[model samples]
Target: MLAACGSADDSAEQPQNQDGETEQQTADQGGKADQEATFPVTETDAVGNEITLEKQPEKIVSMVPSNTEILFAVGAGKAVVAGSDFDDYPEEAQKLEKIGGQEFNVEKIVGLQPDVVFAHESALGVGEEGLQQLRDAGLTVFVVKNATDFDETYGTIQQIGKLTGYSAEAEEIVSGMQDKVDEIKEKAEAVTDKKKVFVETSPAPDIYTPGSGTFMQQFLDIIHGENVAADQQGWVMMDPEEIVNRNPDVIMVMYDYIDTAVEDVYSREGFDAVTAIKEKAVIQVDENITSRTGPRLAEGLEAVAKAVYPEIFGEAEQDEEDQAA
Candidate 1:
């Protein structure tokens, strides 16, 4: 999956009086004004840089899709001035100024003069100098941490919310996400037969699959499905013959880079012997929802549920009921 997701810290600074007085607000305080903070929010970025925002940023730039999604989710979408080339969510993001793709356009960003720019640790390996250049221009650059699971993602949203002076909205978003997760879990637990799933990021020549230590593995666990690649670590290439031997009950394709991704899988030489292929359980999923670790993670989890357990999550079960009637 091209889903190299990264997020922000949860430790947002609040007002510090001599007495260090603080009080938690109630739900009636408009949304959930959970952790109220003062201006000049100072938090350590992913790269160990102490980035301090003097005030709420009126204009912002996001260098990655996940950060862009986070900013929008926290009610700071209107303040966003520009986003990465890949940002296509919330309809409004598509209309924003386009920064470069993998390689960011520092000149365009500098010209925009955003109050703060959100970067990611995943891009630092190759774009470190580019980020430094932004700093040299006297702009505040905050590198969000790499987030793999739901907890880290929630923290990222809340952190952004505090920095942008939208703490209540951020808390509300996280609360809703948690509620959705609980709802999905309750439904998923009823599944009696656990199925084995195989997910591929790419097709054929260079197939990459996420193994242990990834959010996708946890997603499988939540939906009562077993990952055939749980033994491997991170993204690894698996042999086709070994996949045949394992005989997964469902095959999930996570990329749409090619038009015939699912069809190509069906035509694979030895895949026909696999149980998933025989049962026609090979599925193509929306890579964005499943890969992006942001506000929509719960929705993505639902998508996985629909893909793996169609009889329960999708129209398959409804059709069966109608036929029986």
Candidate 2:
């Protein structure tokens, strides 16, 4: 798992002021509002350098898909003024102004004049310079770390909750998710056999699978399934020979590409003999819920658990029916 190494000072726990906002920590000796501060924001990014918000940010801009979901989930949906192109989950997000994709368009983002800018840690490889420019322009640029496992995902929710004055709400969400996860773990504890699985992503030709340090791997483990490519770190391209050798019992198809596999997968001569293909165990999971590390991840985990142990997840089907009725 991609674990955060920084240790928080236990002695630094401070209470919210009479106004309900905790004193924002600062890095400068003068304690100027213009300077940056490293306040304990959340489990992922902690306002690393010396940037202080003028006030608890009223105009937020989410530059990543997961960040947008987190903002909305934590009662900050009304606060979000801008979003990335992929922020299409909550329907409300689609109504917001879009500022380009992960590659970054500084002008588009800057034009929004956001109070706080939420970027992803993964965006560093592509958008770091643009983020830095935003930072240098005195905009509060907050980076949400891409977690590799469940614990990190929990930490992310907790951190976002604290930052957004939704600590109580965030905790409630985390508690609900944790309880579900615990129940799944308990039920699968006695299963002696664990099957290896491979998750196939969309926009083929450049095929990709989740490796060791990813949120997908965590979902696989929660359902007593092992990622066949866990040894490979990050997203990797797998050869047909590798898949044939590992011989995953299950294959996950992102919902967007379900049509691709139903035709393309079966059409392939050699792939038809694969264990998962032969057994017809290929499953479809919502990409919006599973791919992003947000509140809906619990829902995604349930899907994975269902794929692994259909008998245990029979209630899920009933619950869906009840909801529809």
> With candidate 1 superimposed using the best TM-score fit, by how many Å does residue 311's alpha carbon deviate from the native?
2.6
**Candidate 1 per-residue lDDT over residues 1-325, each given as its tens digit:** 1222222211011111123321111211222222354688888888888988887787899988888777776657777889887888766678889887777787888889999999887777777787878889989999888777889888888888787777766776688778878887888987999999999988877788889888899899888899999999988998899889989999999888899998999999989999999999888877787777777777778878878898778743343344246
lDDT, candidate 1, at 233: 95
TM-score, per-candidate, Cα-based? 0.85, 0.79
Stretches of candidate 2 above 4 Å error? 1-47, 202-205, 255-258, 315-325
Question: Could you tell me how far off, in angstroms, the CA of residue 43 lies in candidate 2 after the best superposition?
Answer: 9.4
Best of the candidates, lDDT: 1
Local distance difference test, per candidate?
0.76, 0.65
> Compared to the true structure, candidate 1 yields what TM-score?
0.85
Model 1, global lDDT = 0.76
Model 2 Cα lDDT, one tens digit per residue, 213-236: 777777777777889999999789
Q: Candidate 1: deviation at residue 213, Å?
A: 0.8
- For model 2, how many clashes? 5
Displacement of the residue 179 alpha carbon in candidate 2, Å? 1.0
